[model samples]
Target chain A: GQQVMQIPQYQHVQEGEDFTTYCNSSTTLSNIQWYKQRPGGHPVFLIQLVKSGEVKKQKRLTFQFGEAKKNSSLHITATQTTDVGTYFCAGQLAGGTSYGKLTFGQGTILTVHP
Target chain B: DAGITQSPRYKITETGRQVTLMCHQTWSHSYMFWYRQDLGHGLRLIYYSAAADITDKGEVPDGYVVSRSKTENFPLTLESATRSQTSVYFCASSESGTSNYEQYFGPGTRLTVT
Candidate 1:
């Protein structure tokens, strides 16, 4: 079975501080997707990284994929109050009979205090 | 747009009772998935369907069953509910089952079993 592990199960920071969450997969992934869930809300798609050593940015957030495609990270710069939520990384394994299946990490709960 | 919706946003049941959660998507997406979210367990897949009448198990499919009688409807049933099954259930849909597709999630359904 494939597993995706995320670090810092919970994090709290000042509004202006930076935060980072790491995700590692036990198996190589063909692609990885990031999602965010606000308090009392459903998960929403954020971004996806496919190539090895890939890096993508959206506003204050930066996402990076490891060269081996077995790990990924999300870094938020100068976090805002609106950034408080849970961040999850899901990995799609690279192999047969496992297509369309995504293994999600336990997720990082981020809270920013003003 | 009313992309996806889940019925019975909240539910309460007792042991040995049968329960069903309904999921519908207006996008006519080809892929639909059911996942459960609990404390310390971010989100675990229960079942997924590639199309009408084509369903498969996911990471945490035990004690749960799913059916896709039509392209827009995917229902999940619990034959015999247990306290351990108490969690937030989410239904998601995507245009395709490919690894690159982005999933659209519905407002989750919270079920409490006593």
Candidate 2:
């Protein structure tokens, strides 16, 4: 039973402010994926980090994986109203028969105020 | 019509009644997954199917059953729905079962059990 924990259950920031959410796992993860879910919408794949100490960026957003592959962080620069939504980090466990059994974190709800 | 889609965008059923949620994808993806999202919590995997005849249980698959009769269809069945099953269910599909694959999710089905 792998567990993924997320920080900042809720966050409110100005339109131009920056936002970041951290995620950790009790056990080592094979890979980590990030998702964004808009209010009243379903989750959409954002990115995935596989290698240790990996860092990937999508436009103004950056995602990082810990050296041990047990933690990750998603950071956004100059947040906008469109960035208002819940960010989730899911971990894929190693040696599991299921290939993509994503253990999702509690998710961090982000609200951008104008 | 080209991406993943779920049926009955919203549904309300009584406790102990049977309910089924339909999921279809046009990409002929080999991996399909079901997840439930609750307030303040991230999406938790209910079940997943690797291929048409291969299925496996996930973190929260106790009360849910999933079947993959074809590469394009994956449906979830709740034999006897309960209050705890009242939540937003999402169906996601990925072209590959590999850990690096990105998942595409449906619009989601909101189920309310009274």
Candidate 3:
């Protein structure tokens, strides 16, 4: 079975501050995807990282995948009040008959105070 | 301009009752999934379907049943609901059952059992 762990279960920061959430997987992943869920809302896909040591940016947010493909990190620069939500990382196992099933991490809850 | 959708955005029932959560997608995806979200547990997969009449269990499939009679419809049934089943359930669909494809999630259904 595959497992994913996330760090900093909860985070609170002032507006304009930076926030980062880390994710680690028990097994090598063929790909990883990030999702964000706002208060009283459903999870929305953010981005997906496939290549090892890949880095992608979306405006104020940056995502990076470890060279080993076993870990990932999401960093948000200059966080705003609207950025408050829970961030989740899901990993798809590399081998076996997985059929694209995803293992989700516990997630990091971020709260930005303005 | 249609996407995945879930029925009965909110539901409440007593223990030992039977309830069904419906999921519909217009993308005609080959893969569909059901996941439950709790406070600490990010998203635990309950079951998934790979085309019509093909379904498989996921990480947390106990006390739940699923059927995919059509390519665009997948429904989850709780034959005997319990208090522990109180959580938010999300439905997602992917273009194919491959790691390279991204999953699109539905709004989610909140259920509570007394």
Candidate 4:
């Protein structure tokens, strides 16, 4: 079974500060996806990284995939109160009939103080 | 609903009772998933369906039953609910398994077993 480990189970940052969370998988992944779940809300799709050493950005958020494709990271610049939520990274196993099934990380809970 | 929608946004039940959460998606996606989210565990997949009448277990499928009788509806059931079953449940759908397409999540159903 595939597993994903995310660092910093919890993070508290001041407004305007930077924050980042990393996801590492014990086995190689075909691809990885990032999601954000606001407190008491459903998770929303943020982005997905497929190629090795890939990087994508959306406004102040940046997502990166490791060269080995077993790790990924999400960094947010100038965090704001609206950025508070639990961020999760889900990885997919390469060989399977149902390859797109995700193994999600424990997640990084972010709290921003204004 | 036009997109994806979950019924009984909140529910409370006794420990030994049985309960069901309903999910309906208008996209007619071939892939539907059920996940439970706890405080630190992030979201753990309970079950998934590739299409109607095709279902598979996920990371945390025990005590949970799922059925996809039709393309647009996927329902999750707890035969005999336990206090441990108290958590937020999310339903997601994707077009297929290869494209790394995004998952569209429902509003989530919050259940409490006492």
TM-score of each: 0.97, 0.95, 0.97, 0.97
State which candidate, 2 or 4, has the greater lDDT.
4
- Regions of model 1 farther than 4 Å from truth: A97-99, B97-99
Q: List, residue by residue over A3-97, the lDDT tens digit for candidate 3.
A: 99999899999999999999999989999999999999888889999999999999999999999999999999999999999999999999777
Report DockQ per prediction, comma-separated. Answer: 0.78, 0.77, 0.79, 0.78
Model 4: residues with Cα > 4 Å off, grouped in runs: none
lDDT of 4 at B58: 95
Per-residue lDDT of A30-97 in model 1, one digit per residue for the tens?
99999999999999999999999999999999999999999999999999999999999999888776
Query: lDDT per residue, candidate 2, A1-114, as tens digits?
Result: 789999989999999999999999999988999999899888888999999999999999999999999999999999999999999998888665656668899999999999
Give the true-contact fraction for every prediction, in order.
0.71, 0.82, 0.74, 0.79
Prediction-by-prediction clash tally: 0, 0, 0, 0
Most DockQ-accurate candidate: 3
Of the two candidates 2 and 3, the one with more favorable DockQ, higher being better, is 3
Q: In candidate 3 chain B, where is summed lDDT lowest over 10 consecutive residues?
A: B95-104
- Candidate 3 structure, TM-score to reference: 0.97
lDDT of 3 at B23: 97
lDDT of 2 by residue, B17-113 (tens): 9999999999998999999989776888899988899999887888888888899999999999999999999999987745476889999999999
Tell me which residue pairs clash in candidate 4.
Answer: none
CA lDDT, every model vs. true structure: 0.94, 0.91, 0.94, 0.92
Tens digit per residue, CA lDDT, model 4, A1-114: 778999989999999999999999999988899999898888899999999999999999999999999999999999999999999999987766663688899999999999
